[model samples]
Target: MIDITIEKNLKVYQGKQILKINRQFLSGSITKIYGPSGAGKTTFLKIIAGLISPEKGKIVIDDITWLNTDAGINLSPQKRMPGFVFQDYALFPNMTVLQHLEYATGDKDWINRLLLLGKLDTLTDHKPTHLSGGQQQRLAILRALAIKPKLILMDEPFSALDPEMKAELIGGLKVVFKGLGATVLIVSHNPIELEGLVDGELYIAG
Candidate 1:
Protein backbone atom coordinates (compact mmCIF):
# COMPACT_ATOMS: atom_id res chain seq x y z
CA MET A 1 0.00 0.00 0.00
CA ILE A 2 0.96 3.61 -0.55
CA ASP A 3 0.42 5.85 2.46
CA ILE A 4 0.75 9.61 2.12
CA THR A 5 0.31 12.26 4.76
CA ILE A 6 1.92 15.52 3.84
CA GLU A 7 1.49 19.24 4.38
CA LYS A 8 3.10 22.08 2.52
CA ASN A 9 2.71 25.79 2.15
CA LEU A 10 2.00 27.30 -1.25
CA LYS A 11 1.44 30.78 -2.58
CA VAL A 12 -2.08 31.44 -3.74
CA TYR A 13 -3.70 34.79 -4.47
CA GLN A 14 -0.81 36.69 -3.00
CA GLY A 15 -0.93 34.70 0.23
CA LYS A 16 0.31 31.37 1.50
CA GLN A 17 -1.99 28.50 2.35
CA ILE A 18 -1.42 24.98 3.56
CA LEU A 19 -2.14 21.99 1.35
CA LYS A 20 -2.67 18.81 3.23
CA ILE A 21 -3.02 15.30 1.79
CA ASN A 22 -3.73 12.09 3.65
CA ARG A 23 -4.45 9.16 1.39
CA GLN A 24 -3.70 5.54 0.71
CA PHE A 25 -3.54 3.57 -2.52
CA LEU A 26 -3.55 -0.15 -2.85
CA SER A 27 -0.99 -1.98 -4.93
CA GLY A 28 -1.85 -2.86 -8.54
CA SER A 29 -4.79 -0.47 -8.47
CA ILE A 30 -5.54 2.63 -10.47
CA THR A 31 -6.18 5.85 -8.60
CA LYS A 32 -7.39 9.04 -10.25
CA ILE A 33 -6.64 12.46 -8.82
CA TYR A 34 -9.67 14.46 -9.86
CA GLY A 35 -10.27 18.20 -9.51
CA PRO A 36 -10.80 21.37 -11.46
CA SER A 37 -8.10 23.56 -12.82
CA GLY A 38 -5.74 25.13 -10.26
CA ALA A 39 -6.36 22.23 -7.91
CA GLY A 40 -3.30 20.74 -6.22
CA LYS A 41 -3.59 17.43 -8.04
CA THR A 42 -0.39 17.78 -10.00
CA THR A 43 1.40 19.09 -6.94
CA PHE A 44 0.35 16.08 -4.93
CA LEU A 45 1.52 13.67 -7.64
CA LYS A 46 4.84 15.51 -7.94
CA ILE A 47 5.39 15.20 -4.20
CA ILE A 48 4.68 11.50 -4.27
CA ALA A 49 6.94 11.01 -7.27
CA GLY A 50 9.75 12.84 -5.43
CA LEU A 51 9.87 15.53 -8.11
CA ILE A 52 8.97 17.93 -5.31
CA SER A 53 9.45 17.77 -1.56
CA PRO A 54 6.82 18.36 1.07
CA GLU A 55 7.47 20.67 4.00
CA LYS A 56 6.22 18.27 6.62
CA GLY A 57 5.04 14.67 6.49
CA LYS A 58 5.77 11.20 5.29
CA ILE A 59 5.17 9.17 2.12
CA VAL A 60 5.46 5.43 2.29
CA ILE A 61 4.97 2.92 -0.52
CA ASP A 62 4.74 -0.75 0.29
CA ASP A 63 6.18 -0.06 3.76
CA ILE A 64 9.17 1.70 2.26
CA THR A 65 9.55 5.22 3.51
CA TRP A 66 10.14 7.40 0.49
CA LEU A 67 9.97 10.71 2.27
CA ASN A 68 9.82 11.85 5.89
CA THR A 69 10.77 15.45 6.37
CA ASP A 70 10.91 15.13 10.14
CA ALA A 71 13.25 12.16 9.89
CA GLY A 72 15.28 13.80 7.09
CA ILE A 73 14.74 10.81 4.85
CA ASN A 74 13.95 11.50 1.24
CA LEU A 75 14.45 9.26 -1.75
CA SER A 76 15.45 10.64 -5.11
CA PRO A 77 13.39 10.08 -8.25
CA GLN A 78 15.76 7.42 -9.57
CA LYS A 79 15.36 5.41 -6.37
CA ARG A 80 11.57 5.63 -6.37
CA MET A 81 10.91 3.12 -9.18
CA PRO A 82 8.25 5.40 -10.65
CA GLY A 83 7.48 5.97 -14.32
CA PHE A 84 6.35 9.54 -14.72
CA VAL A 85 4.52 10.72 -17.85
CA PHE A 86 4.42 14.49 -17.92
CA GLN A 87 1.43 16.42 -19.24
CA ASP A 88 3.51 17.75 -22.10
CA TYR A 89 4.57 14.28 -23.30
CA ALA A 90 8.21 14.96 -22.85
CA LEU A 91 10.20 13.28 -25.64
CA PHE A 92 13.38 13.78 -27.59
CA PRO A 93 12.70 15.49 -30.88
CA ASN A 94 15.69 13.93 -32.56
CA MET A 95 15.27 10.38 -31.34
CA THR A 96 13.15 7.83 -33.16
CA VAL A 97 10.49 5.89 -31.31
CA LEU A 98 12.63 2.77 -31.42
CA GLN A 99 15.66 4.59 -30.09
CA HIS A 100 13.73 6.05 -27.20
CA LEU A 101 12.35 2.69 -26.13
CA GLU A 102 15.65 0.91 -26.67
CA TYR A 103 17.51 3.48 -24.60
CA ALA A 104 15.07 3.05 -21.75
CA THR A 105 15.00 -0.77 -21.64
CA GLY A 106 17.90 -2.07 -23.76
CA ASP A 107 15.62 -4.91 -24.86
CA LYS A 108 14.56 -5.01 -28.49
CA ASP A 109 12.00 -7.77 -28.04
CA TRP A 110 10.19 -5.94 -25.26
CA ILE A 111 10.23 -2.73 -27.24
CA ASN A 112 8.76 -4.50 -30.25
CA ARG A 113 6.01 -5.97 -28.12
CA LEU A 114 5.20 -2.58 -26.67
CA LEU A 115 5.13 -1.11 -30.14
CA LEU A 116 2.71 -3.78 -31.25
CA LEU A 117 0.48 -3.30 -28.23
CA GLY A 118 0.38 0.46 -28.69
CA LYS A 119 -0.26 0.06 -32.43
CA LEU A 120 2.93 1.92 -33.15
CA ASP A 121 4.91 -0.76 -34.95
CA THR A 122 4.97 1.09 -38.25
CA LEU A 123 6.12 4.31 -36.63
CA THR A 124 9.20 2.96 -34.88
CA ASP A 125 11.54 4.99 -37.07
CA HIS A 126 9.54 8.17 -36.75
CA LYS A 127 10.65 11.04 -34.51
CA PRO A 128 8.40 12.85 -32.06
CA THR A 129 8.21 15.88 -34.37
CA HIS A 130 6.84 13.75 -37.18
CA LEU A 131 4.30 11.77 -35.18
CA SER A 132 0.78 12.86 -34.34
CA GLY A 133 -0.18 13.96 -30.85
CA GLY A 134 -1.64 10.59 -29.95
CA GLN A 135 1.36 8.80 -31.39
CA GLN A 136 3.69 10.93 -29.32
CA GLN A 137 1.73 10.14 -26.19
CA ARG A 138 1.94 6.43 -26.98
CA LEU A 139 5.67 6.71 -27.42
CA ALA A 140 6.00 8.46 -24.10
CA ILE A 141 4.01 5.75 -22.39
CA LEU A 142 6.05 3.03 -24.08
CA ARG A 143 9.28 4.65 -22.93
CA ALA A 144 7.99 4.75 -19.37
CA LEU A 145 6.98 1.11 -19.52
CA ALA A 146 10.34 0.19 -20.95
CA ILE A 147 11.88 1.02 -17.60
CA LYS A 148 9.64 -1.59 -15.91
CA PRO A 149 8.64 0.72 -13.08
CA LYS A 150 6.63 -0.45 -10.11
CA LEU A 151 4.59 2.76 -10.02
CA ILE A 152 3.21 4.87 -12.86
CA LEU A 153 2.38 8.55 -12.49
CA MET A 154 0.59 10.20 -15.39
CA ASP A 155 -0.49 13.86 -15.59
CA GLU A 156 -3.18 14.50 -18.21
CA PRO A 157 -1.83 11.68 -20.33
CA PHE A 158 -4.61 11.70 -22.91
CA SER A 159 -5.40 15.37 -23.00
CA ALA A 160 -3.92 15.74 -26.46
CA LEU A 161 -5.58 12.81 -28.16
CA ASP A 162 -8.90 12.66 -29.99
CA PRO A 163 -11.79 10.65 -28.62
CA GLU A 164 -11.15 7.53 -30.67
CA MET A 165 -7.43 7.56 -30.01
CA LYS A 166 -8.06 8.17 -26.34
CA ALA A 167 -10.33 5.17 -26.13
CA GLU A 168 -7.84 2.96 -27.91
CA LEU A 169 -4.97 3.96 -25.65
CA ILE A 170 -7.13 3.54 -22.60
CA GLY A 171 -7.96 0.00 -23.61
CA GLY A 172 -4.32 -0.79 -24.31
CA LEU A 173 -3.25 0.71 -21.02
CA LYS A 174 -5.72 -1.45 -19.10
CA VAL A 175 -4.22 -4.57 -20.60
CA VAL A 176 -0.67 -3.40 -19.92
CA PHE A 177 -1.47 -2.48 -16.32
CA LYS A 178 -3.19 -5.80 -15.72
CA GLY A 179 -0.19 -7.70 -17.03
CA LEU A 180 2.36 -5.67 -15.09
CA GLY A 181 0.29 -5.28 -11.90
CA ALA A 182 1.80 -1.89 -11.24
CA THR A 183 0.33 0.89 -9.15
CA VAL A 184 -1.03 3.76 -11.28
CA LEU A 185 -1.80 7.32 -10.25
CA ILE A 186 -3.34 9.63 -12.84
CA VAL A 187 -4.13 13.33 -12.55
CA SER A 188 -6.85 14.81 -14.71
CA HIS A 189 -9.44 17.54 -14.56
CA ASN A 190 -11.89 15.71 -16.79
CA PRO A 191 -13.68 13.00 -14.88
CA ILE A 192 -15.53 11.94 -18.05
CA GLU A 193 -12.26 10.83 -19.54
CA LEU A 194 -11.53 8.78 -16.45
CA GLU A 195 -14.62 6.62 -16.67
CA GLY A 196 -13.80 2.90 -16.58
CA LEU A 197 -10.15 3.75 -16.05
CA VAL A 198 -9.51 4.21 -12.35
CA ASP A 199 -10.40 1.95 -9.46
CA GLY A 200 -10.72 4.85 -6.99
CA GLU A 201 -10.58 8.62 -6.86
CA LEU A 202 -8.61 11.19 -4.90
CA TYR A 203 -10.14 14.65 -5.10
CA ILE A 204 -7.69 17.46 -4.48
CA ALA A 205 -8.73 20.97 -3.52
CA GLY A 206 -6.57 23.82 -4.68
Candidate 2:
Protein backbone atom coordinates (compact mmCIF):
# COMPACT_ATOMS: atom_id res chain seq x y z
CA MET A 1 0.00 0.00 0.00
CA ILE A 2 1.03 3.60 -0.59
CA ASP A 3 0.31 5.65 2.52
CA ILE A 4 0.46 9.45 2.62
CA THR A 5 -0.33 12.23 5.04
CA ILE A 6 0.88 15.71 4.23
CA GLU A 7 -0.01 19.36 4.60
CA LYS A 8 1.18 21.75 1.91
CA ASN A 9 0.49 25.46 1.58
CA LEU A 10 -0.57 26.32 -1.94
CA LYS A 11 -1.12 29.77 -3.35
CA VAL A 12 -4.32 29.49 -5.27
CA TYR A 13 -6.73 32.02 -6.73
CA GLN A 14 -8.29 32.59 -3.34
CA GLY A 15 -4.88 33.00 -1.66
CA LYS A 16 -3.02 30.65 0.60
CA GLN A 17 -4.63 27.24 0.87
CA ILE A 18 -3.47 24.34 2.96
CA LEU A 19 -3.83 21.10 1.08
CA LYS A 20 -3.90 18.31 3.59
CA ILE A 21 -4.42 14.67 2.82
CA ASN A 22 -4.13 11.51 4.91
CA ARG A 23 -4.86 8.44 2.91
CA GLN A 24 -3.78 4.95 1.96
CA PHE A 25 -3.55 3.89 -1.67
CA LEU A 26 -3.95 0.24 -2.43
CA SER A 27 -1.30 -1.43 -4.53
CA GLY A 28 -2.14 -2.77 -8.00
CA SER A 29 -5.36 -0.81 -8.11
CA ILE A 30 -6.55 1.76 -10.65
CA THR A 31 -7.74 4.87 -8.82
CA LYS A 32 -9.40 8.00 -10.21
CA ILE A 33 -8.73 11.34 -8.53
CA TYR A 34 -10.96 14.33 -9.23
CA GLY A 35 -11.92 17.64 -7.68
CA PRO A 36 -12.30 21.40 -8.23
CA SER A 37 -9.67 23.21 -10.30
CA GLY A 38 -7.83 24.74 -7.30
CA ALA A 39 -8.43 21.94 -4.86
CA GLY A 40 -4.76 20.82 -5.09
CA LYS A 41 -5.33 17.50 -6.82
CA THR A 42 -2.23 17.94 -8.93
CA THR A 43 -0.31 19.17 -5.92
CA PHE A 44 -1.18 16.00 -4.07
CA LEU A 45 0.22 13.90 -6.88
CA LYS A 46 3.34 16.05 -6.98
CA ILE A 47 3.81 15.51 -3.27
CA ILE A 48 3.64 11.76 -3.77
CA ALA A 49 6.24 12.02 -6.52
CA GLY A 50 8.49 14.10 -4.22
CA LEU A 51 8.18 17.13 -6.54
CA ILE A 52 6.81 19.30 -3.75
CA SER A 53 7.62 19.17 -0.09
CA PRO A 54 4.77 19.17 2.38
CA GLU A 55 4.79 20.93 5.72
CA LYS A 56 4.41 17.68 7.62
CA GLY A 57 3.67 14.10 6.79
CA LYS A 58 4.89 10.61 6.22
CA ILE A 59 4.76 8.61 3.00
CA VAL A 60 5.21 4.88 3.03
CA ILE A 61 5.04 2.72 -0.07
CA ASP A 62 4.81 -1.01 0.50
CA ASP A 63 6.74 -1.06 3.76
CA ILE A 64 9.29 1.42 2.35
CA THR A 65 9.54 4.86 3.84
CA TRP A 66 9.53 7.44 1.06
CA LEU A 67 9.01 10.39 3.36
CA ASN A 68 9.10 11.12 7.08
CA THR A 69 9.39 14.67 8.22
CA ASP A 70 10.01 13.84 11.87
CA ALA A 71 12.82 11.49 11.03
CA GLY A 72 14.23 13.74 8.33
CA ILE A 73 13.89 10.93 5.83
CA ASN A 74 12.89 11.98 2.34
CA LEU A 75 13.59 10.07 -0.81
CA SER A 76 14.41 11.88 -4.02
CA PRO A 77 12.15 11.63 -7.03
CA GLN A 78 14.66 9.46 -8.83
CA LYS A 79 14.62 7.03 -5.94
CA ARG A 80 10.85 6.91 -5.85
CA MET A 81 10.68 6.51 -9.64
CA PRO A 82 6.92 6.57 -10.02
CA GLY A 83 6.08 6.64 -13.72
CA PHE A 84 4.33 9.90 -14.51
CA VAL A 85 2.35 11.02 -17.55
CA PHE A 86 2.28 14.78 -17.31
CA GLN A 87 -0.61 16.87 -18.62
CA ASP A 88 1.72 18.61 -21.09
CA TYR A 89 3.10 15.34 -22.48
CA ALA A 90 6.74 15.93 -21.59
CA LEU A 91 8.42 14.26 -24.54
CA PHE A 92 11.90 14.89 -25.82
CA PRO A 93 11.68 16.96 -28.97
CA ASN A 94 14.71 15.37 -30.53
CA MET A 95 13.76 11.77 -29.86
CA THR A 96 11.72 9.51 -32.08
CA VAL A 97 8.78 7.45 -30.81
CA LEU A 98 10.97 4.36 -30.58
CA GLN A 99 13.83 6.25 -28.97
CA HIS A 100 11.61 7.42 -26.12
CA LEU A 101 10.85 3.90 -25.01
CA GLU A 102 14.38 2.80 -25.78
CA TYR A 103 15.67 5.47 -23.43
CA ALA A 104 13.68 3.89 -20.62
CA THR A 105 14.59 0.30 -21.33
CA GLY A 106 16.61 -1.77 -23.82
CA ASP A 107 14.34 -4.82 -23.72
CA LYS A 108 13.58 -5.14 -27.43
CA ASP A 109 10.56 -7.38 -27.05
CA TRP A 110 9.06 -5.24 -24.30
CA ILE A 111 9.58 -2.12 -26.43
CA ASN A 112 7.85 -3.71 -29.40
CA ARG A 113 4.97 -4.86 -27.21
CA LEU A 114 4.47 -1.38 -25.77
CA LEU A 115 4.50 0.13 -29.27
CA LEU A 116 1.74 -2.19 -30.41
CA LEU A 117 -0.28 -1.54 -27.25
CA GLY A 118 -0.18 2.20 -27.88
CA LYS A 119 -0.75 1.68 -31.59
CA LEU A 120 2.57 3.39 -32.31
CA ASP A 121 4.36 0.48 -33.91
CA THR A 122 3.99 2.04 -37.33
CA LEU A 123 5.35 5.42 -36.26
CA THR A 124 8.47 4.41 -34.34
CA ASP A 125 10.59 6.72 -36.50
CA HIS A 126 8.27 9.72 -36.02
CA LYS A 127 9.31 12.52 -33.71
CA PRO A 128 7.02 14.26 -31.26
CA THR A 129 6.57 17.17 -33.66
CA HIS A 130 5.62 14.79 -36.42
CA LEU A 131 2.90 12.96 -34.51
CA SER A 132 -0.60 14.19 -33.71
CA GLY A 133 -1.64 15.24 -30.23
CA GLY A 134 -3.25 11.93 -29.37
CA GLN A 135 -0.22 10.04 -30.65
CA GLN A 136 2.11 12.13 -28.55
CA GLN A 137 0.03 11.45 -25.46
CA ARG A 138 0.22 7.74 -26.17
CA LEU A 139 3.96 7.95 -26.57
CA ALA A 140 4.23 9.62 -23.18
CA ILE A 141 2.23 6.83 -21.60
CA LEU A 142 4.25 4.17 -23.38
CA ARG A 143 7.48 5.72 -22.24
CA ALA A 144 6.25 5.71 -18.65
CA LEU A 145 5.28 2.06 -18.95
CA ALA A 146 8.56 1.09 -20.56
CA ILE A 147 10.18 1.07 -17.17
CA LYS A 148 7.51 -1.16 -15.55
CA PRO A 149 7.13 1.13 -12.58
CA LYS A 150 5.35 -0.06 -9.48
CA LEU A 151 3.30 3.11 -9.32
CA ILE A 152 1.98 5.34 -12.12
CA LEU A 153 0.59 8.84 -11.85
CA MET A 154 -1.21 10.65 -14.67
CA ASP A 155 -2.25 14.29 -14.72
CA GLU A 156 -5.10 15.09 -17.08
CA PRO A 157 -3.52 12.57 -19.39
CA PHE A 158 -6.45 11.99 -21.74
CA SER A 159 -7.40 15.61 -22.35
CA ALA A 160 -6.18 15.69 -25.93
CA LEU A 161 -7.47 12.34 -27.10
CA ASP A 162 -10.76 11.79 -28.84
CA PRO A 163 -13.37 9.41 -27.43
CA GLU A 164 -12.30 6.53 -29.65
CA MET A 165 -8.63 7.00 -28.95
CA LYS A 166 -9.18 7.34 -25.23
CA ALA A 167 -11.25 4.20 -25.11
CA GLU A 168 -8.75 2.18 -27.09
CA LEU A 169 -5.74 3.42 -25.20
CA ILE A 170 -7.30 2.94 -21.80
CA GLY A 171 -8.37 -0.55 -22.72
CA GLY A 172 -4.85 -1.52 -23.68
CA LEU A 173 -3.30 0.20 -20.69
CA LYS A 174 -5.58 -1.58 -18.24
CA VAL A 175 -4.06 -4.86 -19.28
CA VAL A 176 -0.55 -3.56 -18.94
CA PHE A 177 -1.06 -2.12 -15.46
CA LYS A 178 -2.64 -5.31 -14.25
CA GLY A 179 0.13 -7.33 -15.78
CA LEU A 180 2.72 -5.38 -13.87
CA GLY A 181 0.65 -5.08 -10.68
CA ALA A 182 1.20 -1.35 -10.83
CA THR A 183 -0.86 1.08 -8.82
CA VAL A 184 -2.34 3.92 -10.88
CA LEU A 185 -3.60 7.32 -9.78
CA ILE A 186 -5.14 9.49 -12.47
CA VAL A 187 -6.36 13.08 -12.15
CA SER A 188 -9.08 13.95 -14.60
CA HIS A 189 -11.66 16.70 -14.95
CA ASN A 190 -14.02 14.21 -16.46
CA PRO A 191 -14.35 11.40 -13.95
CA ILE A 192 -17.34 9.95 -15.77
CA GLU A 193 -15.05 9.05 -18.65
CA LEU A 194 -13.52 6.39 -16.42
CA GLU A 195 -16.86 4.77 -15.51
CA GLY A 196 -16.24 1.06 -14.94
CA LEU A 197 -12.54 1.18 -15.61
CA VAL A 198 -11.44 2.45 -12.23
CA ASP A 199 -11.25 0.29 -9.15
CA GLY A 200 -11.56 3.19 -6.74
CA GLU A 201 -12.23 6.95 -6.55
CA LEU A 202 -10.73 9.85 -4.60
CA TYR A 203 -12.31 13.30 -4.62
CA ILE A 204 -10.62 16.46 -3.39
CA ALA A 205 -12.74 19.57 -2.99
CA GLY A 206 -11.74 23.17 -2.51
What are the TM-scores, per candidate, against the unseen true structure? 0.94, 0.97
lDDT by residue (tens digit), candidate 2, 24-120: 8899988999998989998888899999899898999999999999999999999999989988899999999999999999999999999999899
Q: Give the distance in Å from residue 66's predicted Cα in candidate 1 to where it truly belongs.
A: 0.9
Global local distance difference test of model 2: 0.91
Single out the weakest 10-residue window by summed lDDT for candidate 1. Answer: 35-44
lDDT of 1 by residue, 1-206 (tens): 98989997876777787789998889999998887676677778788889888899899998999999988999998899688888788898889999989888877888888998778999989999999888898888888888878889998888878889788889988988888889999988776997998999988776
Model 2 CA deviation exceeding 4 Å by range: none
Highest TM-score, which number? 2
Q: Ten consecutive residues with minimal summed lDDT in candidate 2?
A: 191-200
Count clashing residue pairs per candidate. Answer: 0, 0
Candidate 1 clashing pairs? none
What are the lDDT figures for the candidates, one per model? 0.86, 0.91
